[model samples]
Every structure is written in structure tokens, then in C-alpha cells.
Target: MKDEKIVGSFQLMKSLNKSLILNTIRTHGSISRSDIAKETKLTPPTVTNIVNELLEEGLVKEWQTGSSSGGRKPILLKINSSNFYVFGIDISPREIRFAITDLNAQTLLYKTITMKEEMTSSRLFQMIAKQLYIMMDEACIELKKFVGIGIGIHGRIDADEGSSGFAPQLQHRNVPLKKELEKEFRLPVKIENDVRAMAIGENWFGSGVGISNLVCIKISHGVGAGFILNKKLFHGTNGLAGEIGHMFIESSGLKCSCGNDGCLEALVGSEGIKQRTLNKISLGYKTKLIERTNGMIENVNGQLIYEAALEGDLLAKDILEETGRYLGIAIMNIIHLFNPERIIIGGGLAKAKNFILTPIQEVVEQRALTEQAKKTEIVLSKLGDQATVIGAVALVLNEMFSVQYESVS
Candidate 1:
């Protein structure tokens, strides 16, 4: 028991040290061993030994030497961002988006394969595997350097088992996604809620990199949030913590995809925006949208509405204002609950930046609790469409490095 405890302690310490050294190199771009030791507060010998191990593993490479003050130039070390690759797949309703990313979560190659709406999860996963292999072949990335596969799916997932629990958009139940993929590819698999995976990505490499507490709210066909609390992805009990889309917004509103009445998604999602515009058209409201969509109500979508708004159409702007107001209510609730330092808005709706952001901020400033509202900064996501896919890559890297979750300041 004494020997076992000592061994475990040693292993933990070694892992922590390795993470520190690698992270230092990653953040500094190229750093000397002495600088790494100073940044990580590890001894020079410890840094050298760990860096040597990383060098042997091909995770780190020696770059050009740094000039010394009065002695021999010191060799600089950097993370070989290209040495290893992680494959990420985003499984949405009508498409499977695949990306091969380097260690830094930068996309090396990206491809999307559209799928039939009626396909089964098994069939989808099979296609996913095929597309990944094709991408790997095209990129000339060997399987040996592939870290693992990270999958982001639309609905609630049993992240531990890599199985779906409830995926209304997917129309699948209890699919053993991780098991099937792992079996087929013979590589480890990590599955996460698509938005949560995006949050993880932001935490690692995007806008939330240094920011500790933030929420990435996605508004598209559905509404959801991925939280980075205290610099770690917060998967609440059952991994459903961030389903803000389903939050009760209206007691008697439209039925959501989740079968909930008056959910946030039902009010502000892509379909919801279209429906609201149609409602206005039905009420005989005059707008340029009639000309914009050629008098076809069915043609009015979120993008058209934003375009109309940008063209100075009052009705379209009003609809967006209403959408932003609803989103603001939800964000106020988010502020009251999480009190995050930053709230990142993404998804299809986020494209209408000023149209949505201004109203949401207006409502938040007026309605949210004074203290929380004052502390929070609402912003749009920088990752854009690549958020979830790159986030999936981040999942693999975080796992391999065993990222240390630091407390938010």
C-alpha cells in the first residue's frame, strides 16, 4: 500500500509537470528550457527531462536557438503543432462536418458530407468513418499520428458511454456512437453535445482562451449553451447542464422540437424567426420582404429577414428586435444563474450581428440584475461555423494532455 501510494503520487506529479511544460511551450510559441522552467516554476533539470521525453515522442521540436546574454545560445523548443493530428466530426441534422486539425486546433483540412434526413445513426456513423478515412488519405496523415476521434452531436449525449439519450433532430435513440466508431477505427472516441464541444474549443483555443467563466449560446435550428466555468467545461450531472434552449420562455408559445411549449428555441430559432415573419405577413404588415422573397412566405428565412433588415425594412427589423428581446430574456436568466464573465453568441442567428446583439444587450442591461449584468460582457463567437468541429479536436487534445482545470479568477 505504501509503495502503491508513492507510485501514484509520482505519476500524478509527472503528469502535472508534463502538462505544465507542454502548455508553456504552446503558449510561448518557441521558448528556451530556462524560460520554460521560469514560466512553469519547474527546475531546469525537470524541464529538460520532460522536454526530452516530449522530443522523443515527437510532440515537441527544437527550433532555432535563442541569443544568450554573454554565453552560448540556448536552444528554443516549441510544440510541433503539425506532429500530430486530431479528427473531429460534427453530426448535425442534414450534414456531417469533418475536420482534421493539428495540435493547436487549427484546421488542416475540412470537408462536409450531406446526408439524407431519414438516415439511421448506424448508417450515419458508417458514412462518417468513410469520410474521415477519405480526408485522412487526402491529407496524407498517417493513422499512427492520429490522436483520437472527437464527435459532436446535436442532442443530449451520455458522454461517458458515447451514446445518445434524446436526439429529436437526429430522430435516434440510444445509439452506441462511441462504441461503434471505436470498434470500426480502433481508436479512442470522445462524444459531446455539439454546443458543449464548442465551449470546450473556445476554452482551449478561441475567445475564451484566457477568460475563465463564459457561456457559448448557440441559436440555430435549436438553442443551447456550452459553458466554460472556471476554465473547465462544466458538464452538469447527466451532462445536460447547458440545455438552455429548452428553458421555459413562454407558457403558451409554439411547440419546440423537444416537444416543450414556449421553449427558447421555439421562440428564437431559425424556424421561429421565419414563423414570426410569416405571422406579420399574415397580419397584412407592409415590408420589402414581399419583394425580397417574391411573395412566397415559405421562402422567408432568417437570412432573408436579416437582409431585409439591413435594407431598412421596418417589419424585418421589428421581427429581429423581437427575437433579440426573447434572447435577451433568456440571457438574463443565464446571467442570474451562471453570472458568467462573458456570453458568446453563435449559430445562424449570430450572423445578424448588430441586428440581434444590440437588442439583446439593451434588454439585458434593462432587465438583468444590476451586479451580474455589469460584470458580464456579451459578444459574438470568433470561431464562426468551425466552432464545434474545432472544439471536437480540442476534446482530443485536452484528453491526451489531461488539461489542468484552473479556477476562474
Candidate 2:
């Protein structure tokens, strides 16, 4: 027992030290071994040993020489970002996106495929596996060079179990995403709620970079949010911490998919916008939406409404402004609760920023409790359409670089 305990302690300490040195090199972009030792507060010998191991593993490489004060120039080190790869997958209600990225999260290849209606769990697995093989063949990188796979999927996720507890869009429950993907690909897999993954992506590589407290809101088929508190993703007790879409806003508003009345999602989701536009059209409001949709009321959609709004259609403008105001209310609630450093808006509705951003800013400016709170930065996602997919890549990178504790067996 004593021998086992000593071995476990050594392993844990060694892992932690390695992570420190690796992260130092990653953050600096190019750093010398001595600098890494200084940054990580590890001994030079320890840094040298770990860095040698990383170089042997193809995780890092020594780069050009650095300027020196008097003695010989020191060799700089950097992540061997291109030597290893990760697969990022985003599964939405309408489509699935696949991307291959390097250690630095730079995308090398990407593809999107439309989702078949009424997809079952088995079908989902097969489709993803097929796409993975296709992308692998296209990249022509050896299988050993690919590190892992990451997935950003909608609905309630049991991240610990690597399964979707319930996916409202697919109407599927308890799908073992990690197990099946790992088995098929013979690689590690990480899965998280799509919105949460978006938040991670933004934090790592987009607008939220360097911002410790941030929130990412996705407004498309539905409204969802991901929270980053104290520089870490905060998953509530049941992994449902950021489900702000169902927050009650109006007592007698439209019915939500969750069987709730006047939820934020029902008020501002894409479906909500479409429904509101239809109601206005039914009330005989004058608008170019009718012309844009070519007299097909069923064809009236968010994009069409945005086009009409751009053409100076008052009714379309009013609907989008109303949507913005509703979103602002929810955002205000978020500000009061989480007080994030910034809030980033992504997904389809974000494309309508010109029409809706003002109303949202107006609401926040008028209602926030303090001057700083009112001035809290709000911006569109820098990652845009690729936010979630890139976030999936971040999942794998985070696990690879962060410290972890494991039981010795």
C-alpha cells in the first residue's frame, strides 16, 4: 500500500509539473526552457526533463534562437501545433458540421451536411462516424497523429457520462455519445452542451479571449446561454447551469416548447420571431415580408424578416426591435445574476445585429443598476457560424493541457 501511494503521488506531481511547463510554452507562443522554468516556478532540470518528454511526444518543438545578454543564445520552444490534430463536431437541429484543427485550434478542413429529419441515435452515430472517416481520408494525416474528438451537441447533456440525457430536437434520450464515438474511432472523445462549447470556443479563441468572466448566448432555433465564471465553465449541480432560455419573462405570453408560458426562448427564439411576424401579417400590417416570402406564409422565416427590415419595412423592423427588447430583458436578468465581464451573441439571430443591437443596448442602458453594469460590453461572436465547432476543438485542447487527478490502479 505504501509503495502504491508513493507511485501515485509521484505520478500526480509529475503530471502537474508537465502541464505547467506545457501551458507556459503555449501561452508565450515561443519561450526558452529557462523562461518556462521561471514562469512555471519549476526547477530548470525539471523543466528540461518535461520539455524533452514533450518534444519526444511531438507535442512541442524547439524553435529559433532567442537574443541573449552575453552568453550563447538560448533556443526557443513552441507548441508543435501542426504535428497533432483534433476533430471538432457540431450537431445542430438542421445540420452537422465537422472540422479538423491542429493543436493551436487552427482549422485545416471543414465540411457541413444537412441533418435528416427524425434522426435516431443509431443513425446519428453512423452519420458522425462516416463523416469522420471522410474527413480523415481527405486530410491524409496518419491515424496516430490525430489526438481525440470533441462534440458540441444540443439539449441536456450529462458531460460526466458523455451522453445526451435528452435532446428535444432529435427527441432522443440517453444517447451514449462518448462510448460509441470512442469505440468507432479508437480515440478519446469529449462532449458538452452546444452552447457551453460555444462559450469555451469564444473564451479560447474568439471575443472572450483574456476575459475571465464571460457569457455566450446563442439565439437560433432556440435561445441558450453558456456561462464562464472565474475563468472556468460553471456547470450547475445537474449540468444545467446555463439554461436561461426557460426563464419566465411573461405570465401570459406565447407557449414554449418546454410547455412553459412566456419563457425567454419563446419570446426571442427564431420560431418566436417567425410566429410574431405571422401574427402581425394576420393583423394586416403592411410589410415587404409578404413579397419576400412570395405570398407563402409558411415560408416566412427569420432571414426573410431580416431582409425586409433591411429594406426599410416598418413592420419587420418593429418585430426585430421587439425581439431585441425581449432578449435585452433576459440579458438584463443575466447581468443582475452573473454580472459577467462581457456577453457575446452568436447563432443565426446574431446576423440581424444591425436591426436588433440598438434595442438591446437601449434596454441595458436604461435598466442596469449601475454605470459600469450598464456599460458592460456586448458584442457579436468573433467565431460566428463556426463558434460551436471550434469550441468542440477547445474541449480536447483543454483536457490535453489542464491538470488532472487520476486514481492509480
Candidate number of the best TM-score: 2
Return the top candidate by lDDT. 2
Q: Write the per-residue lDDT of candidate 2 for residues 41-120, one digit (tens) a residue.
A: 88899888988888887788988765688887779999889998999999887789999999888999999999667366
lDDT of each candidate versus the true structure:
0.79, 0.81
Error of 2 at 331 (Å): 0.6
TM-score per model over all chains: 0.88, 0.90
The digit string of per-residue lDDT tens for model 1 on 1-409 reads 1123222111332477888787778778899999988887889899989888889878889987646687777789988888888899887776778999988887899988887663555776677878888898999987767777888887743334344335432323324667677677666677777898888787787777778888999899878998888778887665567778888887645887667789898889888888878888899999999998887878888888889899999999999999998999999999999889989998889899989999999988888778657547998888888888988888777766664552121
- Ten-residue stretch with the least lDDT total in model 2: 1-10
In candidate 1, position 159 carries an lDDT of 39
Error of 2 at 220 (Å): 0.5
Off by over 4 Å in 1: 1-16, 38-43, 156-175, 406-409
